[model samples]
Target chain A: MGGDFHWVATEPSGAGRDILPADAVLFGNGRQALYAVLMEGRRRFGWRVCHLPAYICQSVVQAARAADMECRYYRALPAADESPDWPPFQSRHEVLLSANVLGFSGLDLVPPDWPNENRIEDHTHDPWSRAACESRAGYCLVSLRKTLPTPDGGAAWSPLGLPCPSPEALIPGHAAAGQEKLAAMLLKRHYLSGMAVEKEEFRAWQIQSEAAMSIQPTSRPLPVTASMLPHLPWRRWRVERARNAEYLTDRLLGSLTAPALEPDRREVLPPPTPRRFPEQCPFAVVLLCRNRRERDRLREALIQRRVYPPIFWPLPEEAARRHPEAADFAARMLALPCDFRYTPEDLEEAAEVIREFFQTEAG
Target chain B: MGGDFHWVATEPSGAGRDILPADAVLFGNGRQALYAVLMEGRRRFGWRVCHLPAYICQSVVQAARAADMECRYYRALPAADESPDWPPFQSRHEVLLSANVLGFSGLDLVPPDWPNENRIEDHTHDPWSRAACESRAGYCLVSLRKTLPTPDGGAAWSPLGLPCPSPEALIPGHAAAGQEKLAAMLLKRHYLSGMAVEKEEFRAWQIQSEAAMSIQPTSRPLPVTASMLPHLPWRRWRVERARNAEYLTDRLLGSLTAPALEPDRREVLPPPTPRRFPEQCPFAVVLLCRNRRERDRLREALIQRRVYPPIFWPLPEEAARRHPEAADFAARMLALPCDFRYTPEDLEEAAEVIREFFQTEAG
Candidate 1:
């Protein structure tokens, strides 16, 4: 399992040399990387952080609160066609967290003129490539567990600079424990479907143990271990994901409106494109329902059928009252599954179920 | 799976012979039942909830806070010739939650002068027969998932005059979904072993789904399903638990003391006595450490070895400061496992490990 696979940005073609210079990379699991930046931003830079809306879980909000930072939500503007009335930056020393929404939309909507002291791009949705190219203060964080086979791995890279803590600083036996836990989690996820939901608790336990294992007074730059970068069948994963998404989209199109994706923009990647976006990465198909009530009804119906669609992140009542447009959009949105796990046939079946539900109602 | 075992009680079969009549049964899983009765107590009956000091977990305190109740801690007054406190009911409650403290001490500790309104027993711990009798509360709650194979089953029974909702009043398909979720949880717990730690997400998902499924119109009582009650191997479970407790107690006698019990006070039962004096149900062996630091250190060490020993419940910092003696007692207490899952050999092995730990420290 140690030397099984290696993560290649692009498959080596004896044609060109690797161009990216290595900076201080802070390796972590998905949420860990997110928190690392949040903690760093507040402690080191004293920047106030504002998060994007409808992107992730309330745990992220709780994490922000844990860091004693105020969280302000901004709606994800509709693909290149519509630009949001972006709120004024309250402070120049503010930090913006541009989360990769459903792993598809972030690259296209990187706010061009946003002024901030630092920017943390979260690639938990898709860690294959960096979403944001340049920023006043750019630090991209990637959670490997979401997209890759590795049980636990996360990396924070900064083109500007990185404050890499040394390996000596790491808790003793942490890497081994982490690897073991990751293996256990992956095994349970694949072999025992019943145990998949328990992954969060396992991760929490790992976090606690890892925290305990951290050694004080450290000064060795911890190199990302080869064990962390296992070979991921990105091409195969991407192809299946795209097919599933397309199938679901076509099936749901009659009754549910899938979120619009701009066709003009090509995905940001290196030349030769070992990974084809059209064939590989179709993250999620966000559907717009008739109303909040309808969306909730659809959710409940799907849940009864053992299909758990993503939940709507309820906005704080005050925020909703202040931003009616955001509130309305949040209510109507429902993110459907379109990952490597589901097949095209599964998507078609799901779509059929959705169609029949609405068709029966219409009749 | 449904008809594989038999049900037994401590007392002679009476009028409600076919179906056991539970007085104010607490429903939901172990944690939820504890929360429902203890946490939710303040809202229904203010200032009557008195919690024991020797319990495990901080969530209980959180539950109490959520229910707008204050927790009053009591010292576990040790019996004559015992160094450590036994059957810790040092304080009185108008509404006492009879937690089957590791299946033993709870029954005997129901004070002779206990007020009738003061007995809300939590059968989550032992859940055998007599523990139910210890509570004279109008209502009692049982976490069905803990003892039975059912995925989700909870009962609220009242001994005093109160209207019990008829079977016709239960929500449609509520029991089925709850059972399925509970089955999934139990299966994961049994088969996955360590993976059970990670199942929080799945449990949360199940909780959300169950909550949705159980919503009934306030117009009528939801119907209770007959299939919810299955024959559990109470006798076998009790015997195994008692064996394990005895094994550990013998090993820890010199170093740590078991909770005391009066031998002559044991009650008769239908088959397996549900209510046991300290001698009868002695599986859960709780010991008082030197201090909170020692207790926490031991807990951490045990966790590192992939062995979890229950520590005393966390006292609120404010409360601890206010009641130093109670805090001191809490800091020193640790509960050893004595579940039916452990055989005599397993209990011996666990005891040996614990003995070795203390012995090595002493040397």
Candidate 2:
């Protein structure tokens, strides 16, 4: 449970600048924010087609589909040390949605010539990263719940000083769901503190919260999230996450075999360091195995050692069919827990498990 | 804040029978439960028109409207000691939805000859009453959150062992909203215990929760609510409520003016007794003012004394036009809080405030 990437209540410290932009519109969750942004584009510019990365979370894909946008898949995840191959686009009618994937790298992903008016950048993985702050996309969004201890929060902002779609008053059901998640986060803190709390207790609330969020696609952020945002220690979290991710990457560097990835798929990218990128935080320490079989074997071994890592995503069927290389990347990728939850010592223990797996168990 | 009827976390004690029937389906809130039932009726029995009480909460009206049911107004309150006059029905196609208002008296409301298949009894005001338990209606529903400290809960059951409509999994937004309410309840307990908590802190959450519940008309109850229900001391709460209500009624009996009422308009019903009706609990101590002006005056006076009793409802514009007697009753009736939150001593202080308002302040 200590190594599992579950939510826990983080104590608030000194006040900082608001995590989100002043003009950003808030929503109950990221999918709602994305859907609202897409619908706004359709309303304002008659946008119909949405170009998305095939190697992405299903939630992004679902948001586009829910907006009734025609989706076109594009390949992401370039080979080692190469830039992503940016595709040519027509006009504002065809919107592009790209994510700052894992917050590891993003500087080269944005094509300078791409129309900012037709782009939406997602920084859900790491909103504190430089990529998010410097994004030139028409719209930028972040799912704050992913990074912060808040139960529900999604913010969509216009980086180009354009108007963003504002959500109406939150529906009570959505607010209630958010509150449930908040309770879960608090319960998790108790569980983590060695209290007589069942792991399933928080997990059940979390699962229910997710189901409720999926049902209500659009709503304003809960009042608690709004009030709690400024109080969250974002800078500390950023540096801590960076240290953890970097420590894990360093520990695994020699032990992990260089994955024989396909031409379009990349080997793992080392996490950003706090020294190089003070504001940036890696979403996780990315680990890529030689194949899907090896990835699963390693994942199971890590789980046995109580170091639970998550697959970034399993590709959707259509995405898998359309972009085989992205699908291949998905099969091999495992995101180790590298957020502010653990210290370098904890990562060292995790590193020992990983070394044991690769040196003694993995083929 | 001491006299205010806000939520507080109640400590769970010994296990009792589940508050809801085993076969009953749960929902995020009362409106959702009612809406789902109406929709189910439409799907099964081709039920079109729904007859509702003229004197009712807006939530009940909205639920019917959301379900697209044709609503008909029925006279619910009768002269003192007289029964509610049941109107002629047109088979099961014209469904009747009636509430056992305040749970003070309900045995006389049901027309013995009416078809049980067409009746939907709302026991939200007091679900544990003998009237609710012994009802011959086809369906009976209660909004548990109204009585229990849980954030959100609505249960629709059948007295005749008939099948009921089942709610789908809770939407994450709604579940989150409920969780928010739950958090508010816990915070409220701290506030009540003389902690330095701002009143606005919990009120904001409660307001947000209500908004979310309104937006989502249907979903299964949050798992927290389901788990918390059995542990709640319903029997003790019921007894305490009865005691508080009875003591308040005993004190206010002579101070209250028996209004020169119309034959259609009834005098206030005294709180039910624990000795005579062990399972029954009065929703509140009902007081009928001489007029709207006097009612408003007394309400303000109580607020000055830090007692915040809510108006059961204000008549909808259309309902006011259709039922003058019910509209007048809504304007004049005040429900004094008599829940488990207050002791007899607390009620005595509230009673003193009420008596002073009538004795010296009244015109």
- Per-candidate TM-score against the hidden true structure: 0.42, 0.59
Instruction: Name the runs in model 1 displaced over 4 angstroms.
Output: A1-124, A129-138, A142-155, A159-240, A249-280, A285-336, A340-346, A353-363, B1-102, B105-125, B131-157, B162-240, B249-280, B286-335, B340-346, B353-363
Candidate 2 Cα outliers beyond 4 Å, as residue runs: A1-17, A42-49, A65-70, A78-80, A89-93, A169-218, A254-268, A271-274, A304-307, A343-349, B2-149, B152-296, B301-307, B310-363
Candidate 1 residues A1-363, lDDT tens each?
Answer: 111111122222322111112453444344544566666777677866665553344545555566666777766633334344444555656666666555555345356566434666665565543343343346676555445544345566675675532232333244434433432332233223232124343344335434532222211111122222322355566566666666666666544332232212211111122443642254566666667887788777776665667644566777678667667756776667666666676667666666666766555
lDDT by residue (B219-284, candidate 1, tens digit) is: 111111123242344556666766666666666663432223221221111113333443345435
- Per-candidate Cα lDDT values, in order, are 0.48, 0.74
lDDT of 2 by residue, B19-43 (tens): 7767778888888888888888898
For every model shown, the clashing-pair count is 40, 31
Largest TM-score belongs to which candidate? Answer: 2
Tens-digit per-residue lDDT, A1-363, candidate 2? 133234433224434356777788888889888999999999998899998887888888888999999998777773345456677887768998888777755575576668888898988988877778877788999888777777788989988886788778777678667766767765565456444456676878778777778524588776656655665787878888887877777777756543432323324456323355654567777877778987898788877877778787798687788888888878888887777778778889877876777666434
**Deviation from native of the Cα of residue A136 in model 2, angstroms:** 2.7
Q: How accurate is candidate 1 locally (lDDT)?
A: 0.48
